[model samples]
Target: MLFSLITMAIVGKLLHNKGYEIEKLIPFVLIAGLVAYFIPIGAIIIWPFKVLFGIIGGILGFVGGIFGSTIGGIGGITGGVVGGIGGLIGGVLSVVFGIIGVILGIIGIAIGLAFGLVGLVLGLVFLFFIPATILFVVIKVLHSETKIAPDRR
Candidate 1:
């Protein structure tokens, strides 16, 4: 989490230095980070599982097709239809989950940007404020020290 925040800040700072608006580029940076780091890693981790599932599903499907064929006529058609429907449902669900992931990613980026900006503003305020305040106090003390008292006589 800290690493990601630091990375985002660095990327934004670099872009800001290049005269680009960080706000507009943050999402692209985030997406690039995700694609560069996460996606390939995720795919590498998931590949074996995907292959295993595919083989298992194929074997089960073969057995199911044999069972359906033994039952003849409508049973075979029904199994095929059911498998098609299941595939359709799975496709829809993958799309829905993909969309949800995108939406959540966008929301997360927005929140991070908002917090980063707020921190930046507060930091700038305090960064100047503390020094300015010390200068004001020092000036007042010096002015008081230099001022001569009026003669009582």
Candidate 2:
């Protein structure tokens, strides 16, 4: 556990320095570590729950980081307000759709690509696009503010 935490911290810092944000990685890493630690301590019955929780935490962390970055990039109160509203909507949609799809899969109402499709949609909408949008927006804002053109070299 200690080693995991230390590793997470170091990796988090490295990612941050490489243009990734802490908010996006910390929750997922912590949840993953906790799940790993608990599997050895708990019985098999608890593993599934731990895994599910870890997934949920990762999703939430990803969305939250995107929302934060979006708000941070806009550079004013109006941007913050808009970002907050958008984040709230996005978060709700992501959670609802993700849970529904997972439930459907477990209940056998969905199969194969059908199950994966929902998950993929949920992931793309909440996980990938949100973070990429925020990162792009932030980089552009920073570039504009510093008057330093993005390096091509």
Please provide, for model 1 over 1-153, each residue's C-alpha lDDT reduced to its tens digit, 9 standing for 90 to 100. 444455566677788788888678879679656654544655677899999999999999999998887788677789899999999999999999999999999999999999999999999889998889999988897878566558745
Best by TM-score: 1
| lDDT digits (tens) for residues 42-143 of candidate 2 | 446688998999999999999999999888776677878988999999999999999998898877755777878988999888998999999999989877
The C-alpha lDDT values of all candidates are: 0.82, 0.79
Regions of candidate 2 where Cα sits further than 4 Å from its true position = 1-41, 76-153
Model 1 ranges off by over 4 Å? 1-69, 72-77, 144-153
How many Å off is the CA of 135 in candidate 1? 2.7
In angstroms, the error of model 2 at 80 is 15
TM-score of each: 0.41, 0.23
Q: Output the worst ten-in-a-row residue range by lDDT, candidate 2.
A: 36-45
* Count: clashes, candidate 1: 0
